[model samples]
Target: MSVTAPRGFRAAGVAAGIKADGARDVAVVINDGPSRAAAAVFTRNRVKAAPVLWSEQVAKGGRVRAVLLNSGGANACTGAPGFADAHTTAERTADALGDSAAEILVCSTGLIGERLPMPELLAGVDTSVAAAARDGGLDAADAIRTTDSVAKISFRRGDGYTVGGMAKGAGMLAPALATMLAVVTTDADLTAEQCDRLLRAATAASFDRIDADGCLSTNDTVVLMASGASGTTPDEEAFAALLAEVCDDLSRQMIADAEGATKSIAIEVVRAADEDDALEAARAVARNNLFKCAMYGEDPNWGRVLAAVGTTSAAFEPDQIDVAINGVWVCRKGGVGEDRSRVDLTGRDVTVTVDLSAGGASATVWTTDLTNEYVHENSAYSS
Candidate 1:
């Protein structure tokens, strides 16, 4: 169970003939809520997708009755017609659930610079809405995959409530937001303000801490909807922690299933001047192509890590920095410590730790190793 694990929510997925193959490409999630409080985070990319632009306004209202998502056309960079398609999708969803268009949120993911198949997509909305049921979350999750090999879903049971979510991403995963689409639902009693604050905090700690290829997506969107069906008002701190755990689980799944990735790497930065400095240093290392390629080749190249960190504006001195690969201190005091050959990178997971020697603050960013297949998959993506 994912989104539908929570009470007052129903979901469904249906094939809409959007993708070349007859795969499920459209999904609908409806909140039959006593309270329809909702909040969302979208890609910060300046070249916004039509669905992102539409959902931003709906999210601003702090309430949503339903969300419709499709996974074959990004509907980005398609000019005015793209916006109209998104608007029509929302309006049709609102009509199905007896609500206003402003109360429906829309999300899309796939190739950019293309228009959505409106006829098929509108028909899909009708079918998905009609088929929505409490156990349809698995289908909904499955419908939102492009290059993903598996559907990402997570759920956590809290005191008298449940938080569940589903997400999809395979490439172009970067900072400010990954190239992804996520929908999270909860049955706990919460206000729109609380939902907004909790969603932002959870994303800052999870989704914002991952980088795959350093390419931001125009269609990235994550939404949190509260139904208030549990009749339990959870402690803000506890709920935020649960939400962060769910988001983190989905984020790791994205990296593990990243397009053509062989190794899941964690860049941990410690002893920075502040949290921001630590994040900056870690993200720089995570996005460095040389560092990623080194990991893919099973080489513990500490110099690449140091060079990447040096490009950051973080407060750190050259001689005081230390680098460790898979628990082996490969570089100490910015010089050589353990033999590079002693560092192991033979597994599917790798960890690179950097000691900034500035303060007590720390952060970790997750990423994947670059490979030849990554280049091949992306080069032929539009084909």
Candidate 2:
């Protein structure tokens, strides 16, 4: 259980035959609650998906009852008919739950530039609604996956309230949002303003720091719904901290299951002029595909790391930076320092630490290595 791990939440994932092989493609989550307060963060992509446009409105209103997600057609670039399908899905979900359609949010993922099969989608909605149960969290998590090899689920328990969430994305993973789709439910009492503020802050430190493939998804959506069933209101800072923890756990899960990734890398930028510089330097290295390939090969290539660090706007002296791979100082003062052969990357975890020596600020970004499997998996993703 993940999405339904929190009180007052029920979810279901159903096989609607949307996928050719009959994998579960539809999911439903209902906040059977005394509070319908909600908030969401969506993809910053200008050419948005139909479901994203629709859900943006729902999220803005700050109240929600049910969430319906399908993972077979992204419903992006499909224009008017796609929007119609998303609206219809929300309407059906609202009707099934005996709630207003305006309170229903819909999400879809898969191949872009294609229209969803409206008939099967609507039918799946019915099945998902009828199948919704308190124990269906895992099923819903499984249903939302596209190229992901494993389901991503996370939970954080507070004094009286608990947070539960599930995410799906293996490719098109980058900052400013990714192909990532996530749903979080909680039993805590929170106003819409608090929910919205917390979601942005939590994601900034979690999902925003991951760059698995460096490609943004038009269908990306992360939603948080509070049912207020716990009957307790924890401190705002406490709730926010727990939310960030849960988001970080889910982010790690996403990286571990990233498509065709042979290893996970943590790019840490330390001693920067400020947090912004640290973030910039870290992200620049994380998105360096050449460096990612080197990690896949277990090669200690410090030159690639320095080249990446130099591209960032972060304040740093080019000749003063130090680079470490897996705790081995491969490059010191922008020159070779340690023996390269001593740094072993045979394991799945790799860490690239860049010491700017510019200030005291630090930031960390997560990324995955590029591999043959990654190329192969994405080449046929739409098939």
Candidate 3:
């Protein structure tokens, strides 16, 4: 389907001399208004990318006019030089947008430990600025991809407002944010604090709950910007609902596109003492490579799920745990309950449910099955 760009946001994409493949590598998203409120979330990992560090600090003020992003090289672990390159990118973008350098957030994704091609990137910035247009959102989305096979984008329209987003990540994904880089734009009138609140809540159930592999990225980031172009402003509750829907759509897309993924798994944990407990249990299973691989082979390995949950402190009695796969009661009271042959998992989407019987809390985590292709893809990734 041909997705439309969000209202009031103009975008541009051009080759930044970063990708040797000759695909567009740099992108900019500009708010055409006088100013806009912004909120952002960054990788929880201490070893963060230079651009993430810069953007995190800039987002503290809750105002941003533009964002600069590049692919093909994650400006990470390069120490001071990487920071300088990131700052230069942001400064150039800000200059083009006629805003302060601090108002331009920056993001980068790709191979780590290499310095960005500054000369080419600087030159490309001008080209991107010149190409800026209202219909360039798709181009910008396409420019930020690395190992992703296809660009991931989504949009939701509300009363006189819209929420649009794009994300990229095919591997090095897990909770605590993944190797993903996402940009969400909205035309709603919202304060920086409100945006932050809505974003955090949305992410907790969406991106924050997905696991492709156990690995995390140094450049993970999710940013939201409000152009305030829409005159209609909804209440906090209404806005939060819409934000959740947008985030859910983006999160599902990310899981479906996981590198070497032939099947997507949704691990639902129910009847936990609280939300955190349910999430902890679900994530434990989501990150289990053995479990994922078994599922990939269409093996009804309920024991692996039990083992994963047992490793967590989620207050679940072993005998009270119930498991279901694709609506088949695979296990009851921690043991096999039904015919394993009845469950079918040849489809691209798979669902597994674990009932803790501890309380009323519940959580769901999305993950992908592990296969030989996954190993092969990462084995020679750096080469």
**Top model number, TM-score:** 1
Model 2 misplacement above 4 A: 171-178, 380-382
Residue-level lDDT of model 3, residues 44-133, one tens digit each, is 889999999899989998988888888887888899999999999989887777779878899988778888899988887878877888
What are the RMSD figures for all models against the true structure? 1.9, 2.0, 2.2
Which runs of model 1 end up more than 4 angstroms from their true locations? Answer: 172-178
- Candidates by lDDT, descending order: 1, 2, 3
Question: Considering summed lDDT, which 10 consecutive residues are worst modelled in model 1?
Answer: 170-179
| Selected candidate, larger lDDT, 2 vs 3 | 2
State the lDDT of candidate 2 residue by residue for 1-383, as single tens digits: 79998899999999998988799999999999889999999998898999999999999999999999999889998899989989999999988888898999999998888888988999999999999999999999999987677889989899899999999985433222237899998999998889999999999999989888778889989999999999988799999998999899998998887867889899999999999999999999888999988988888999999999999898988889999999999999999889999999999989999999999999999999988887766664434
A best-first ranking of the candidates according to their TM-score comes to 1, 2, 3
Could you estimate the TM-score for every candidate?
Answer: 0.98, 0.97, 0.96
Clashes, model 3:
0
- TM-score, cand. 3 vs. native: 0.96
Residue 308 of model 2 has an lDDT of 93
Candidate 1 residue-wise lDDT, 1-383, digit = tens:
99999999999989999989999999999999999999999998899999999999999999999999998888898889999999999999988878899999999987778789999999999999999999999999999988888999999999999999999996443222235899999999999999999999899999888888878889889999999999999988889989999999999999889878999999999999999999999999999999999988999999999999999999999999999999999999999999888877899999999999999999999999999888767665544
Give each model's whole-structure lDDT: 0.91, 0.90, 0.83
